[model samples]
Target: MVKMLCDPVCPPPNLSQHPCCTVKCWKWDVNQITMNNLVKYGILILNRPITQNSGFIKNLWNRATIRMTVDGGTRQWDKFISGLSNEMQTTIKDPDLISGDFDSITDEILEKYKAKGCKVIHTPDQDRTDFTKAIMELNTHRKQTGLELSHIIAVAQTSGRFDQIVGNIQTLFLVKEELLLDPNTNVFLISDDSITWLLMPGDHVIYIPEETRQHKRAWCSLVPVGETCKYCTTTGLKWNLDNQSLRFGGIVSTSNTFDGSEKVTVKCSHTLMWSMRLPTIAIS
Candidate 1:
């Protein structure tokens, strides 16, 4: 079983004296299959099959302040709910918005959601991927509605076509430049087996549960994306890096485990993709 920890306002005492401008804290409540105190967050379903357990996805969908689908994801969302019980289907409401080029979604599916009161947006800019365009639409929604969501959880799978998977990651890097999001806004990619997000150059405190740190099969990784990390340091990992470099074809931390600590700290000179395996939990 995975342990749950409350979100602390400040870093723990051990990390209090760390010489970093700002300390970004993270809690893996979603990965641990638990709900935290309701905060402003949105869900963005991509154009992929919803392979996650229905109940789990439903819980997230209901809790999300805003729900959206991109292109064929409208079909995917409809198919996901179609497999649920009548009670479950009724409880899971239609997406608040649907945006993407119409190339992938059929007219019938589009019309169904539109009639259900979903805001259908046609974004035909071929320069950006559907995923990227969807984020833009999400931002626009936030402004128009004054939602001010602090987090965006993108539900996607990592095992699909390699190019699409990489394209999704590229979108993470492009988010800051694409729009003026709050400096603290976080974008996460929730996969079936792992929770991944980009850690910009700064100090970060990621709270991992005690059970996960000690679990034999649980693992985490720090992959430098787009550029080489010149100075990277970490603590609470089985294989901690001490101001070492991490880059492709050189040194990257993959399949690394936690060092029996409830939290993992990372200090990197550049952006690094941090991913951790989800604890094995039986979904009803």
Candidate 2:
């Protein structure tokens, strides 16, 4: 029987006995990690067919193998299909598959991909987000084909409405660990830019790459979501805090940075959050 790894990611029971297990890299702040070594796989999830976002699709096509469209707020199936731009029309017609509720996908586009052997699955579980649905579908397809994907390039995942952006961010929390197993998954809110996620309990080194810009300076934050905290320490930032504990009303690591490569290490029971600005359409 093939060995199957289980959820709740952890190390092998007997490290010495097993002798061959994926090394678990620990980090606190994952700021400067690169996509240097990893199997790269791509999946595109569009809320609706693209019309004017041809540049986005072209960029995604450069990385992704399978493309998926999910039904969202727009409910007009025929209109949505007919309204797609020529480029989007071509992509949808030639994608690996189309999986989503048929509420918004027009008959024209649907028939086109289906005729080309695109497997369409109509999933209408309101409780589960469409983002989750597409991911589950991708995982299933990956298993069926015996293809191992390193990362997923999720396009147009953020945007549409305020609530959706929030839901999408929450979705990051849900899929963070699952993505770590594969090459690596990038969830783009919109355009070619992306939102990367990280967790706590390890030490991390972060820095802006030379390719991004001649000089990179932006705010870095460590937000403690859901609750307050106590004690915080950081380095390589304008405002340095050591042995300093923060609470709901206390100091938070917001809008802080240093001259050259900024390095940060922290020990926190809460999730420390950070965001930095980069050049347009930066994918690394």
> Model 1, residue 142: displacement in angstroms?
0.9
For candidate 1, the per-residue lDDT at 5 reads 25
lDDT by residue (1-284, candidate 1, tens digit) is 22322232333222334455354644434433434333678888988888776777888788889999999888888888899999998788789999999798899999998899999999999998999998888888888888868678888888879999999998888885444354456678878756788876667777775556666788899999898999899999999999999999999999898888877888887778998876542232
- Each prediction's whole-model lDDT (CA): 0.78, 0.50
lDDT of 2 at 157: 36
Which ranges in model 1 have alpha carbons more than 4 Å from their true place? 1-33, 36-38, 280-284
Best by TM-score: 1
Query: TM-scores of all models?
Result: 0.87, 0.64
lDDT of 2 by residue, 1-284 (tens): 11111111333222344456543423222222222122345555556433333343454454456655555322222344456677766554345656666666577667766787867777788776777777777778877887766456554533457786566656655565344233233333332333344334233344443433233544455666545546566666568777676666777776665545434445454445555443334433
CA displacement after TM-score superposition, residue 125 of candidate 1 (Å): 0.4
